[model samples]
Target: MNTTELFLVAMLIVFSIPYLIWRVFRTDYWAPLVVVQIVTGVLLGPGLLGAALPEVYGAIFTPPVIASLNGVAWWAVSLFVFLAGIELDLPLAWKSRRESAVTAGFALFTPLLAGCAAAALLLLVPGWVGPKAATWQFVLGIGMACAVTALPILILLMEKMDILRQPLGQRILRYASLDDIAIWGVLAIILLDWQRVGRQVIFLVLFALACWGLRWLMQRLAESDRWYVALVWLIVVALGADWCGLHYMVGAFLAGVALDMRWFDRDKLDQLRHHVLLVLMPVFFLSTGLRTNWTLGGATVFLAAALLLAASVGGKLLGIHLAARVQRWQPGEASLVGWLLQTKALIEIIFANVLLDKGVITSGTFTALLLMAVASTMLTVPLVTPMLKRNPGLIGRSG
Candidate 1:
């Protein structure tokens, strides 16, 4: 009836419904609870639940309730992305620079080319491109979405599949980590507001200085002290970035990457990540799904999703397979690595959301990319299960 009750109602639904479906149906093998939660967010959004029960949807998700939920969702994703940034093991990547470069480059670029082609076609349609987007921005935004790998989700899926600590899993993480940097860089390009370009330039200069000081302070602190400092740092950097037109998530990532992972205990860092996902990320998923639309109609959105998924999966596999040939990886390794690299749940959604906020892509395109991301993620475990099962020795091989 009131905002608090309604907010609680919304919270209860987001947390409960997805878990119930995931647990009751035993969807863990195919769709993890996080994926299920993302789907649930869509189902509860204007396109589905709202379309079916407009009054109820409006009543529950009133302005105040929506605002409150959004506050949680924003901080949830901010922290999650921050953690993703901190987890990047760039040192490991540097150790295997040659293999990492050729593979990561191809893995990012080929799909980028393919996705641009797909985006070019979508430009021929009207509803898919946002009003504020120039053609180049739209194309590049969609392409980056196609190329993104959800490092955090990839880790989760690999852990579930029991390969996360293995040599293969660690190697896969290196590839994803490099792409994570490129994804944000491209997003900055897409979001570059010429009017704000001066401000952005200033932000970069100051941010560099801040990072130096931040690094020095972090090195001197105890791990316990570092945790609180990191939070303060996350907020300040995120605000500064948003002020400069780079977006707060970019700031969040920069905030984390400025510090070393060795500063925190590895297991505690992992637990903090785990806690963020369990406690807060469901709100982000629901917030993301609420932004989805089928303005051109549901069938059109679904069809677009299918096309994008094909481009994403095909380009990723094609690129990895090519890289494998160049690097002389063993048989079946490309498929295993490519499939794992295609994980795109949280990061892809976050990328699409940023594009949508900046009006670089329309809701129709966002919905399509969101669907593509979920489908690509769901396909990973199912497709890789048989390969890992049959190969037996594929768990940890030197790359």
Candidate 2:
């Protein structure tokens, strides 16, 4: 068949297989449809599908088709990341600064240190670090990947657990919000190019001035007009960021961060998020899958994934438990909070993708990080459910 037909066929597979598995197996108890979609993307990637059925994979995912899918995926993820940035409730986090700072600081730093250690170990061997990466870049990049919490996915999980509006949930959001800001700041640092430092500096200076003007204009415009202007802003900033040597996603996030969530209707923002996920993000997931490479061997990749996951999960629990002691929280609260914060679904994937694009991590390392993210996300609900069941009062505890 032609390229368009093949692209359509690929899309059909992308949507269908994950939905069927999600629906038929009742995996929502453990793996949400989003998780299933991510897992399916890996299974369909070159390492699996290309290896298993090269002819079929090649026929469907030809160069032209892959290029088309990538165009869609880029826009999809840029928008998704932009929305995530807008969802940062910094004002609320500031209102509860001490607890949020202690938790977010510990939660972000501990895993980061652990993941850096793991990255150092990976450096002992070849094939893990990207060609262009400095030692510090690879280690810090991997460290940040391990530390990332998927704020959007965390919101979804909290809603699923029926605690999104609860006191506990609000607290978690505050912690995640602060970490989300730090995550992007660290990303910009990692993406900093000495050769293009002048360009990046100019981009930031112009961006700051433009952001102020955009905010003034947004406040005056109707909400309907704000949406249109926001898209234009997303495109322009993303272009500038990419041109200046930082990833377009960095610009996309900055674009969203410049705007206040209150500027738009809350329900409309939520609906926009939901609709973007439903319509666009699956393509991003599939495109992510297509990038997976296991050339270093499956066993090596899985071992690295296990190492990252251990560092991520273990460090998160330890950090949160320490926070619990400091904050004088009741027993089991740390475990609940830690497991929830350890979630690395969309954000980690995005982080890894940026690292991969910037040559800070190899495709092999990307595969490992992808595996780690999927495993970390899939562990959240099942583990958290039983904890909540045992201590229903935990949800009501505001601190």
Candidate 3:
């Protein structure tokens, strides 16, 4: 069996799991569907099925095939970010910038700062040294991981809840967007220190300037008679950010902010999102699942996972509450935003994978973080919805 055939088989299984779950249960339990796909993928990978059906599974789980699938996943995420950019509304965020900034601040940067503080403190713990030890650098790495928010998933959740155009939804989305930009800047700094300090600093400044230039270009294109030209410029800027050592996501986000400044078209953005979600985004999620290794035999691994889960949940809520107080957000709204934003998804996982690839975090640590992210997200989804409904005047209010 070749990669294609194996992938086809994986795809078949991935597609069928939902139906199987639907048949077994009367509810739309996407989580179980996701779990089955991951479990099945692992079973069919070199771990299990390859050990049993050597020839058939080996061909599909080959290094080249895995790399190819990962590459596809990366591309899918890139598209996801691009569409995320398209969906943002600059005017709305601008109109509500102060409140949104407070929300976004608590939602992202507070946890990041807290994570950094924790990491800095954890560095002194005896014997926690070397490759996997809690060093200052590693602490910084963890902080970065904690600070990230996957806007696509947040937006999707908002849309599904039918609050996307509502006040709370707009406010949450706005803050999340603002937080995304700020976090990218932080990531650029981390990469600079991790990659090349001197060049990274210089490049970061240049990247900021380039973002300004790109914004101008996008705005011009948006206003021009040639609507298609805006998209072309967006692509150029998106790739250009990668060339300049900045994440392509930064470029995509800038493109979105620029688009928001001009014409905010929900229909067009939705169209792009629809295609990306059905086709590419699932590949990205499936690949994320494939990368996750849930098999754990050690108490240490379990402890680490548990600690991370507790920290992730506690940290976000605490951070958001503190930030809200600092920024003078209403108590009800603050609590709502804090609880909801704790949920992690693709962004944190993908970035952590990048960190692992860079040797900033070990594979074992990355796996732990991925689990922490998924667990936090799962817990939040069910919990946040009901909490928000309970506080209609705060988080549930429209306009």
Candidate 4:
């Protein structure tokens, strides 16, 4: 197949998936849409059908093409993160700061402790992973992977369930809002610890200055009479943060928050969401699906995959439930909150990509983590809806 044919095939998959999933089958087919997309990827790549049609497959998914796809996917993720930060109702977060603090602390530490324990256990088992170098990398990487949650997934779920207005939803959202901060801080510390002090210190100092400077500039930009200036400032802040070694999402989020003060027009956020999520995110996910490699299969891989799923879902549920209970939420509501809280969507995908790029994990491991993210999203939606409908009162009154 030539480049033209390969492009056509790529376009077909991209066009067909959304049309088949969203337009034809609608929401009823979402899970299958996800399954089909992933399975189609596996089949069309080196895994199954690709083996039978190696020439065509190789022509399509070459290294240069894959690299280009990743670049596009990264942009999509950056926008998605920015939109997430923008959508975050920081007022609500502040109102529930104590609960948010509890939830955030538990969410971060529980997984870190569990992942470290798992790493130790993995070290005990010979042949479970590769040699010492490989083992340490896998353990630390998997630990970070387990600890990460997808902020985009959680917000979408809450919106769909109409729980964003409710207390349980607010708590979860607030926790998620703070979760990103903690995640980046932990990651920065880890990255710094793993790097030379001079570079690390330079990055940290630059990041602090950038954050402070952006805050000042965004305040000024928020009052701009020209709409384009606001948008430009948003981009500048995002790009600046990206350049400073902070995630673009963090910058976008801070930009949003900075503009979110009482002076800016409330309508700006709605506009941001309209263009960002509706327009950009689907393209990103498609490109992400294209990058998945399922040919690297084995029982050990499957086992590690299961562990990641458990760590993500089970750990979040347990941590949130305990936190909710401490907040004096009833058992039913707390458990339901726990169940609802584990839905991870966008940020997890972004984090997986980051880990993969940083050499913290393999492509195959990232693929498994992505699968876990989709599964967690699907499970949380159904689990939370009944709780929302049947007992809105059960959500929580504390905060």
Task: Compare the candidates by TM-score and give the number of the best one.
Answer: 1
RMSD of 2: 2.8
* 2 versus 3: better lDDT goes to: 2
Worst 10 residues of 1 by lDDT: 288-297
In order, the Cα lDDT scores of the candidates are 0.85, 0.86, 0.63, 0.62
163-266 per-residue lDDT for model 3 (tens digits): 76677776676667777777666666656654455544665576567667766665565444434755665666667666655677777666555555335365
Which 10 successive residues of model 2 have the least lDDT summed? 288-297
lDDT digits (tens) for residues 1-399 of candidate 2: 988899899889878999999999999988998788877877877878888999988888888988998899899878987886786565666777898899989999999999999999999989998988999999999999999998767877887899977889888877886787688778878877576788888999999999999999999999899999999999999999888876687788778888899999999987888788889888887676676654545698899999999999998898899899999999899999999897787788878877888798988898899889989999999999999999999999767
Clashing pairs in 1: none
Report lDDT (Cα) of residue 329, candidate 2.
91
Model 3: lDDT equals 0.63
Task: Point out the higher-scoring one by TM-score: 2 or 3.
Answer: 2
Candidate 4: regions farther than 4 A off: 1-12, 22-52, 61-71, 124-137, 165-168, 189-227, 261-264, 294-296, 353-359, 362-364, 394-398
Candidate 3 accuracy as TM-score: 0.80
The digit string of per-residue lDDT tens for model 4 on 1-399 reads 665566556657655765475556555324524334443454555655466887876777776665665566566666655656555667777776787788777776677666656656655545444222355555765566567766665665566566655666666766666777666655554455443455445655665676577656656753655346545656776776666556677766666655444545567755665566555555555665555544455666566566677777677767877776777766476667667666555566666666666666555666666676677666765666666677767765545
Clashing pairs in 3: none
